[model samples]
Target: MKKPVIFLSLLASLIASQSCTNLEEQVLDESFSPSISYADIANGTLAPVYALLPSVFLHTNYFAIQEISTDEAILPYRGGTDWGDNGIYLALHQHTQTSTDPNLKNTWNFILQGISRSVSAINEFQGKTDATSQLYLAESRGMRAYYSMLTLDLFGVVFVKNSVGETSKVIRGAEAVEYIKSELLAVEPNLSTTVGPGRLNKAAAWGLLARLYLNAAVYRNVTAQTVTFSNDDLDKVIEYTDKIINSNQYQLSPDYFSIFNSDNHSNKEIVFAVDQRAELNGHNRLAYFSLSGDQFPLPAFPAANGTDGPAITSDFYRTWVNAYGSQDPSVDPRFYKQNLSIYSNPADSCVTAESFNINRGILRGQQYGLIRKNGVFLKCPDGKMKVGKLYNDTRNRPTTPVIFTEKVDFTVAGSDYSTGYRVEKYEFSKKSSSGRNLGDADIVILRLADVYLMRAEAKLRKSNDAASALADVNTVRASRKAATPPPALTSISLDLLYRERGFEFYWEMLRRTDMIRFGKYEDTWTEKTNTDRNKRIFPIPQTAIDGASNLPGYLVQNPSY
Candidate 1:
């Protein structure tokens, strides 16, 4: 294998100096020696490309638009003070975001950087004839396609560039869909099946193709009131999903929460995920972001606490309530996981020598966790750790108990610290005991359950195979082996399927796309009443548009942003 030593050295130096924003330009301009064959460039050469994923998918970046912008999540101005961020979150939830929103801008930069790095890698490996070089080149193209899919999904445009310095063709609508599909199809054969979910593999490519085909209608026409689903496209979706299902490389995990646990990198359920192992720069914001500030999960480090970020919206919660009816959602394993057994009885205090795990899933009502006093964890009478009811001591409502309410108002007066129900889906990494930085849990992007659901949806849409679709849906529903699992549905409709997706994948950053595909994106939910079809895709960052201004119509912002 040929090593691109010069490329690696420059990348490291650029990253160290915080001049990574010009990574694409630097890599393109600096010529690599032809004697340094692509064969020597081992798999580690692709690390820089994959490294861009963590920041792009960070809870506060792309996750915000994918979730918070829809009814699934909301980050209100906590206690009329925190998370205000000049109304960026508020505007996102309200569908009033502009080109200058920091979240959108940062997300754009991160994703574009991924695309650039992938392009550079592809260029480096181009024309290599060796088997190893071909395999790596295929993986690079696959990654480029994956990032392009995200770009098209979010900003409604795909920048198709063959090389770093060459002008990118801004593509959207059907053109964008076809380009991505071609890229994935072109690389699918060379993708290694033995690779892990963290890396792009054959199975991951199949999953991405299935997803692209399943949402082909939406990608083609973002604002259509009744987007037509082509039977051929649906069949393609089914074909690809069936390929993955038949591969037998993955299975639905019996423990739903286990799929999102800190040590879930080896879990079979995950077909594709952002690898957030301890060695990588991963963020614990997904776990601690929605938790109450005073409720610290890790007793070993009292300073590592929550920021009281986004919470599950009441409108989204109503979906679960409406489905279960009278039965609490907590009964379903997917809805909530009670990990803190000692805190079952809030009044009972326990002494622990080590750190304890907190409860996971959608948290509602009064909260309880390890209490801290004077910058240290409060200890029990015997000099061990103590657990007690949590309060809003960190915010303005110091005296109020930390009881998460079902309803959260958009206004400052009504949006208190404890308003909306918070979600704690991902486990807080013990490695990140002191801050919100080092997370080890791999953020799931594609999984087997989702694959089954996509196939079920394809079956339903293609030929209205209700019996087969029902079986598929029931297969997922039965996979969650809770003490009393959610019973199988005898019948399934498109609406029922959409609701099932919500129940299975809430807070996983699939809500906005699901809502849009199901024709529910424009429906008024919580504080968001804006039904403007143009808000379907966010505006292309003004900076990006200005950067290309000299090229004359090189980049156009999305409609009505």
Candidate 2:
């Protein structure tokens, strides 16, 4: 799938000179250069789109802010004595500015770049007789549609452009959805059925379409938007899910932890994932975002990695416990595998309830002593425990282990254990440090489990198909070895669906969209309260506003702006 050298050069020029005085001007100038062939331009376009995925980890991006906006998670750090207020975007998101913030702008930029690349690829395949080029062009369309979904969700409007040089045509609401549908339908002929996950395939395009239609009512108030589901949308969702589930290209992983394990990449459970290669591609800070210092296992963890952990709020953890706990909390396995808690123990010998205790040793005593879910807690050369700045008792010092009931937060100033749960998704080896560790874990962007859950949601909404919906939901539950799946899916309310989504897709980047779709976008929480309605889309960036003049209403700020 390697492309021509000219395309590579075009990509290099755009990415390498990203910091130039005027980005739009620089890109526009590069687009007009006749030396670059259409084929070269199309081939080079993908480099930046792939490059953009990694930029989510960039400081100015929405990775952190979007999470804060959703109820699935929240940061404990508020305007406090030692905490950094910059993470305030989380609070601001919950409260104000939906149309244009720096985060919103970055998101807009990210998806547009993705769309641009896809369009470029589409143009490159125009004259090529090669089947591979057509396949790639189709994949590019799917990618654009996927990104356009995000853009519409976050910004309420996004520009639709066909070629690299064309000015964007701003489309909003139904128009945007139609545009996305058109792209997917048009490219279906060329898209391959077998391209594995992380790469968009024909089925994946349908999945996105299903998702878009499922959430249509929320985006635009069609009649019965909340209570009524369109039969057409429901059918599309089912059709798409059927194609993927029956395709045999993917399936649910038997072990919950196996999905997150480094060795289990490319497994059947994963339909697609952002392939993060340490040192080569780009590493997702997911490792750094969800980790807590107190419970972190490695002595060299912080030195080797950035420890800006996002802890689980006590509320969300309680929800998981209430939903799955069978009298004993650890019975679920997912709670233990996906999160770090006081009860987590590293010793493989300790299996059942009685053998496991949160208050065991210096490494298991203090707040930071809690065991991580998947990886073993490592010991120092002196046999003492390792502690981060959050749990480092000044009086006790790092060398000495505080082996008692001293309460200290095991998180950084930028984050707090406001929710009281931190994610343990990626399990790095005891010997590994930083995201560079061969923790070659595949980040599941789409999986069979999610498809099942989504089908249940769509079915329940479409025709009160509670029995069928329950079966679909329970299929996943049964897969998890739940002694008894929810009997008959009696409570198929939106709230229940949300809880199901929370439990099923926790820590994935879908939370913000889920919240928005469920009419919970404007709601308030522990550290987040609605600032205004326009804040829902994020403010159009000041920079963008400054750059375009004739685009008067074209760049009109979202509501409350």
Candidate 3:
């Protein structure tokens, strides 16, 4: 639903009044603003807080730092020109990021904005006795805690502020952990259990809590050589995840890809997500981001194409090859799904069809799509459609066939348009037939599979119950059935669990954190060689540091910026 214009104006004014460094800025005192009534406040105060989520998760913002920095994904300058934004992506992948990186700055700003907006919503809802107002008040607080969790995850610090104009106390380590946990616990009772996944509810709060406790050790020691996961914390992870699992509110989708389909808003597997319905200015970047520029999914809109973005790293691709030796990974349903059936016969291309979908999962080898001639799609003599091998014509390399090589290099010659395997996990939105803008798929933030995995990890780490952990892992694996379904694992280990997470959640933007938690972040992969532990947490953005310069110790840069 669209928010009131008056509320939007007030929010704009509040944001404009403060500098980027001050996340806890002075919100416009809505008590004096007569234009907004309790009805309007109840309807629109929380909209902006939720609205900031899409931008925060955009491909160029938080997704870049989360995925590109890990071995799971890489983004080199295509043709030594495209995506060369001052080597920001290269620096991120290689662990050479400084305080001034634009991607970091953008990610920091967007997250802080979410926190700022949440604070504003809380301030607007305080002391109102209406049932709706009280419900929103609890939700606002819950969202603030969630945003704080993200802040702590990325920058190793959480900003604490209760109301407008209040100074935000930066807390880290154990103190920050307790602060975030208390906020969620305080609001849990009042949160609705039946609200959709887009909004914070009782189950979402529990999911977030489980996630926090699962990674508490990492947050507790951002720079330590080895950190210990406490038994109590692991127990908490199990407890919370068990609550979600028993609630029966979610399940593992039999069709693994359906969980990410365009109509996934109603998918029971999703515990929490950013509702990117088209009416709310949703975008299709996630679907288009990792695809090749020459590959177009929609036949009606030839202009809607990929941007030749990031691709899977060879180090990551090897994980699948090593796991299932002597068998192609595509035998597992999650590894690949061939949707373009007409292309099965390479020589017989002519087919009468109006539209078709490209293959899903990890895409490699020569690509194919509709051929064009004289600025129009070429058709067979019978007026039927025709498909041919795709070329790098979109990147001015028409002579070069679009064959994705398994290996990639940082050098310009080695990082061409067709250097590495691409991923097409999220289905392209049919609503975005005109271009890559309007997307209806809700971006998944938390899901039931993750809940099970977390519980399994806790069981293994806390009690060394390998049998129970293996049960949980196999439960997820068996849910995804295909012509040749994935076999149940006869064993389980920390390393095996880590690889399973990669297979399940790849391109969902959880790689960097997973790598660090699995103690593999510092391992040499592809072009990255640095093994510095201090680089675990990104440096606090330079702009934020400068903005808080006058206030001594308000915002200290992470160690070894």
Candidate 4:
């Protein structure tokens, strides 16, 4: 799954460079020369789309909007002043985002940026003559379809652009879903079989189809109702998932922690990902966002401070409690309760120097890592590591020991650091003084374990079939576990499947989709008590509607905006 050398060269070329995301794409046809071959230009067509992935899938982008809106994660303003971006996180958790919420606008703009880039790529490689060129064109369409699917899923609308700078048809509901599905299937045959990570390939297309099929009913329903899963839809889910599983193109990671490591480009389980390298322009916010200021993962490196806030809700943490009943997180492969070790390396250039086994999954209890004393990490007298205590960084108790907790009140007045259990799914950058604010590891857009979980859900929904679903669930559980094996269940249900997904894919940007599909989104959780059904899909950004010169009346806001 290493990055292609041509793709690396594509990143360095001026042809791949992009103007502002909000701006129009300029035609670069005349700039190509005899020295820069046609293949390079064709590959260069894909660079903008690849570059836009990080903006859409990063921790603070779609990942936060999707996960924080549900119970999987939250980023409350620390001590009331720090993260209080006009109460975006609180409003998100409460399902109260308006058309003016900056978070929604940011997410919308970034996804549109991706769509615009994909369109530009499609227009640039329209008359390619080589297999490589055709593959680039196919990848462009596939990437376009992928971005459109996200747009449809989140906003319930898709902008149909036949070519660059063309007026888009405002497609909504089932029409949009069909458009995205058709686009993906059309390019499925042309995608490269050997496309590496960060690039969309046939396997990724299959997974996307399965996801679309899984949610086809919801997309069609528009209005909230009990979703009836058709046998055909279930078959498509099972079929597409099996295609990825049987192709042997990818497999579940033996160590779940390795999947999120800073140097995880080699993991075979990653079907498609955002190629994020510190030197190649990546951010470390995924790891740095949740970590407390005192709990430094890399003692020698102080690149960017970890702004602690993203943590699991009590309801989300209670899922494990209901399943394991105080069982140690080590017992479950998906849950890494403690972040104990680091991967230390000083000699490697263009990579973070500090490295250790920083744990993955949900974190609870007293936080322990390198403690910053004065300017350096403080050690212990008994030779054991010193556990760090977080403080209410925005309030009167900046130095007090603010222990982490699972119970959180979204409407409470004071900001307590001990509101919820923190998550460390992404590896932190080990650079002591790296200038870049981005993480070194590529953010995983889709992985094999999640696909397996989808197959399991499809089986359960098809006919309450448990045995087949159990095998798939246990398959992932076993692959991610230590020496001790997870107990195989003799039965499976929707509740079990939901909890299993929570264990498997927490904070990877699937929680909102899972919660909706399982019919648990409307139920009260943590600080969210909104029962309005319209809150399921976000309102189309008002800015977008105002900016839509072509589709003025067509770009209507979603209901109850």
Candidate 5:
């Protein structure tokens, strides 16, 4: 996070300065401050573009569209209140989301705001004649391309902005893809390979290019019965992935969990990430989104709370059941989770406090963590550490303390608190000077592991190179030191590739696109059955359409809205 500390400090100073002056007078007019140069503003202008990432990446917004909508995750209303939120969660999973949905509208506007900021940064950088100005210009253009890619991915159309405050013309399908490709390629040489995690660079741009081509067929023709992956696109995936893999700039992290730790800014695994800091308003959704309220870690921390939202689907979890039956992640080396225990038995742990330390994968069976009892932690029977019932905290109504269990049937009925296995992929940020909920962890957007997986998939899809694909997949598996390592598969198939992606990149914002490309998004799974083929892309947010009223026909809604 400190690699670009100068730019970060400048941006912070500008934000702090805005608080001292009247809001109305801070406009980009001739009345601009005589003390500060426009170059100074241009240098820090990318801050707004960076600011929009957290909102887009948060679990309830863009993440909701990417993951929750697929079979990987779901957030059901506990006791008809905790997460009902007008049935947006249910609608997303069920593929019945309307354009007016708050999440959809908010996410759409947030990405547009990023586009707006990118345009502003470019204009400001234009006025400055310096080496630093060119760097800023390239980074700004890269950011614009990234945001535009997201807009095009989620909603088929992207707004075309020639300059600031101009009416953006909506470009969809093939046209949008071409624009994004051209923009990324244009900025690639100018982008600094130095200073990353917080800023986009050459490697990140290459990763983005790889992603675009990998999904180009789907982006160009979503309505095709089976989207065709051309050899050129597949080669591009391999070409760009090799650039990162052979560049020697990045490598897979030794500790898989450390890649998501609060101190992950230095992790080599990350190609591009949101440098969320404890000092700033960072997101903690990945840390506690699925955790029960009573299962607090380091409860001594003040005012700590977990929303108890999303949990992985049973079908997703069942992917682990291989030819050898249910794989115990303990020995599975790389592709496994720590074993979860239910009680504070001396047999499991000589000291009860030791039982609370659970594994870092799909959490199932009885859960154990710090439990409050009469202002102190209560120990279990003959057990050393504290234990108590996990109350269903919907409406703050403490329902009967129930032991956590796997309810194979997900989409729990109203008030049926126990169901799907909770996901704990991101290392929880318990120890931080700044707020834990606003965590310190840098959320990784692209990584080396993903690069490897993408290569494997591209190889499989393009040339039926099963042996090479299997080797790539196994390389990732071998990297992790699981207590019980699942043996690497001897053969590879499209189905295995799809499951491997779920195993490697489940909670990350890539599931929905993966499901569609794999031809599984339309299949029935758990609570989701009404999957109309056309629902692959969400309806363009109604707010986006209304906001573009000034442009008339330019912002036509995508197909069915």
Candidate 6:
């Protein structure tokens, strides 16, 4: 079968097997005729799209690939085997390619399917006017533009279809942007401004537009071309940001951990989150993949290897630690939380000793000690987080020296060892009886903190003297308990902003985009140094190319394919 058809079938199977009930029975009637009223079809279409958003991060598949591909984050120290493959894809995306990869095809197919469903709803409800119908249509358009942005970011071209067929025409970069803007702008007037936290509303649509305009430079090859942000676009960003920030609808949680807790879904910090329901085919990847071998932290789980944890990269970890050098590290809780050190120094032989050594923090099995004095974990030769400890037989031995074979989560309460640092940003603090999958913590997609950083970049680009920009950028730093914001600056560069973003939005999937936008796609690193520039955009999977051959060159493979 064609790739798209195969994918759709896969999605159907997943839904049928995993959903609480048959999706067709709950959301649609398989018995319903193709001639069903357009209004019903529009409402029925929402279930799948809403379901897909949270599932995007269900594996090391799209979530890590999209982020690591850009620069927001990396899976260094070989914690995760697949992250390097993601790195390869990102490197290749920087230039055009004739390469065909199945994973790339799957990502493209899923993203485009989302867009197609969104467009189908729009097409079906051209003149529907019932209150529910209008709301659903607006929501559908907002979602459509959201997915369209994904296409524009990854592929630089997309097929903008109005119906659920194969004859849709391809929309290229600038053209795609225009189409997205039109859809969002049209839906803004009709969308209810008072929607709840997880669902899309007027501000969500506007926020997506802000992102598009903010990255317009890179999207249209204008980042280094003296391109200026249109006043209108800037105004819209500020306008939407202001609405979300001041609407009393959402507020930044005083504690960062509260933002991702299972009980914290309604927290004001979240602007838009993929609604993930547990054990029933929801977004459970973070909780699943992030956990260590389920050994040290929880003694009862099946895959409990205290050593197989996902530690933060040394480079990225340094960015967080450097933010607070002038003062005592003990005073800054962000460091402790963001970079937890649990390994007991074997030589010190002091169980009562401080959780970390003042000089050498965590020791990896490679026998190298990362300097905690500087606040960054020393990375392995490859970019993955260094592995501190490994389990030999899952026998629950604490003192045994396990090899550095897998990723470990040291920050997770039970794991007492670390190669470098564990990402505590999304760490679940509470226990869930339901298979340990009740992390209701709403992942912040676009929070006020990101807005300030984006505005700071815009200001830096506009006004060479960016002392105010520095202040705005540092506001997020201060939120993390920095003594004071990073120093004011008379002038700023993208490098500075890029570092700030790494510190501010690390692990939030903005890294790859930020790196690409700042023209750092070609920059080298310990493991990610030799990536191909064209790999910046993932290949238009070989499967997709073959499926589209019947469309002539309309669906031509991306260059190099």
453-554 per-residue lDDT for model 6 (tens digits): 777776666555477677776566566432333343344577878876765565667777877777776675423554455555655666555555554565
Instruction: Report the lDDT tens digits of candidate 5 across residue range 45-104.
Output: 766667778767777788888988988887777655578888888888888889878777
TM-score of each prediction: 0.92, 0.77, 0.93, 0.88, 0.87, 0.74
TM-score of 6: 0.74
Instruction: Give the true-structure RMSD of model 5.
Output: 6.8
In the order shown, the candidates' Cα RMSDs to the true structure are: 4.9, 7.8, 5.1, 7.1, 6.8, 8.9
Best by lDDT: 3
What tens digits encode model 2's per-residue C-alpha lDDT throughout 1-561?
632222212322444334212222124223747687655555455444544554543323555555656665555452142234454554443555444354555555555656666677666666767776677767776777777777777667656766666666778877888888888888876777777565777767767777787777656642222434568877888887887788777777666666766554567787766665443343444554543333343444434332433444455566766775575444544545422242344432222221222211111122444223233443344444422223332222344442322122223533332224455555454334453343445566678888887888878777878788777776776675423233334556658878877766777667777776666666655555553445556656554554454345556666666
lDDT of 4 by residue, 366-409 (tens): 55454554455445564444444444342345566646776666
How would you encode candidate 3's per-residue C-alpha lDDT over 345-457 as one tens digit per residue?
67767766555667889999998877654446667898877778888777767788888888776887668888899999998888764558768889999999999999999
What is the overall TM-score of model 3 with all chains considered together? 0.93
Ranking by lDDT: 3, 1, 4, 5, 2, 6
Task: List the pairs of residues colliding in candidate 3.
Answer: none
- Greater-TM-score candidate between 2 and 6: 2
In model 6, which runs have C-alpha deviations exceeding 4 angstroms? 1-27, 30-43, 70-102, 222-235, 246-248, 279-281, 288-291, 294-310, 326-333, 338-420, 429-439, 465-467, 480-493
lDDT of 1 by residue, 1-561 (tens): 633222222323334233223222212223346855433454545766787788778887878999999989888887777898999999998899999887787777777778877887898778978888788889888998999999889988887878765667788999999999999999999999988789999999999999999988999999888989999999999999999999999999989999998899999999999998887656646888898888888876778788888888888899899988999877788888877665566655775746467889999888888877677888877886787778877764557899988878677655777888899999888877355777899999999999999999999988899999999999988988745678889899999999999999998889889888999889998888999988888998776666565556657778886
3 or 6, greater by lDDT: 3
